[model samples]
Target: MDIKGTGAIVTGGASGLGGATAALLAGRGAKVTIFDLNADLGNQLAKEIGGHFIKLDVTDADAVEAALQEAEGLHGKARILVNCAGIGPPAKVIGRDGKATPLADFTKVIAINLIGSFNVLSKFAARIHDAGTIGGEEGGVIINTASVAAYDGQIGQAAYAASKGGIVGMTLPIARELARYGIRVATIAPGLFLTPLLMSLPQEAQDSLGRQAPFPSRLGRPEEFARMVAAIIDNPMLNGETIRLDGAIRLAPK
Candidate 1:
């Protein structure tokens, strides 16, 4: 559980929360590997952190396996895996145009956000299981990213909410299954965070969103999320649970 010198893999490490987690883990002396589709940013971040970067699409099983091998080659088998690669494209099931949301788009969201997470987690867990235990633990810890939308989704978030809800729903069972191997599973259901996707909105829109928070009245920071991740890694008893990183904000139906 000690992060110092531990091997860690972070999916979607090119930017946003994943990038922040990578930097924090590196700062804590963990040997980090970044798995992302953004080759340029991934490579740069790997260089900056003195770690490894694998250009990978988490949804591709073959690519995920190959990337895991590459990461193991660099830092041995990873003891910490963080699933942060996800997409949130907002659309109503039935829009004002009276057209139903495209089924393909909804499926894509689930593919990337839910199935993609499983792909990386399964690959990493297999490697860890094969390599055996570290520090008396059969494996390492896994942190998955969910969203507050999973609990209280605003309008036009059907796809995103379903995907994230799947993540939240999977936590307990996965943790129970991994316990024999000493692999902990946890999830973070984040509130409104100022990720690139949110930043692209008009400033006024951004301000309005921030004002909705119950406390501090602002978007969560990536570093704040990173801090929670570090805490989860260090605390052995924290397992099989989803922690909401929202500032006590129950979103209204938009």
Candidate 2:
């Protein structure tokens, strides 16, 4: 769909992949709204990009609804919703002591990574469907963030992988159900990327991670992820699929 003058919402747009997407969408003339927990960065980035910012906890139902309402008030209902609010704190299911991981740790990941995505998507789709077609397009698009862990989770990635797997699992069914409304759903399974957190790592560690990618031998860039988002947005034929952005790397069990 044409992005110019359209409305879009990107969760966790304060930094990393989401931030890159918001910037790209705004640069393309779409009215963008950034939903993130980081209020200061969100506000700053919004000002820089000529977009609005809303502090939101994707896991909080009331807050998400309110945030969306606030966003629509500023830029109409967003037809482009990018789900990028997630966290991955790795821990083994059974440690050296043979103690099982804390249930809370696992649940928290699922809550934020999986349920949080659904929370935003369900609300966004409802509003988009209610608003009907957008600028002659059938409906809208929802891009979810997954991880290579979903396919080849390492030793400490059980929770993280499960959460991402939920996103992958739901893509097709959700797309088929929303087909009538013209809302498409897709996902991106990213490999190691030079996100801010990773950038802080020692150069040696960073280089090691980059070399893990077979051919490119480098971590993916945030702008590259943003470009993929744009391609997915423009290609209506791309739906209900998860495109692995990794450079031919199936992560080894750590």
Taking the tens digit of each residue's C-alpha lDDT, what string does model 1 give over 1-254? 99999999999998999999999999999999999999999999889989889888899999999888888888888899999999887898997889988899999999999999998998888878656667776478999999999999989899999999999999999999989889999999999998988989998998899989989798889999999999999999999999999989999999
Question: In candidate 2, what are the lDDT values of residues 35-103, reduced to their tens digit?
Answer: 999999999999999999999999999999998999899888788999999999989989889999899
Stretches > 4 Å off in candidate 1: none
User: Which regions in candidate 2 have their CA more than 4 angstroms from the true location?
Assistant: none
Query: Which structure among the candidates has the greatest lDDT?
Result: 2
Model 2: pairs clashing at backbone N, Cα or C within 3 Å: none
Error of 2 at 159 (Å): 0.5
Every model's TM-score: 0.96, 0.97
lDDT of each: 0.92, 0.93
Cα lDDT, model 1, residue 87: 88
Best by TM-score: 2
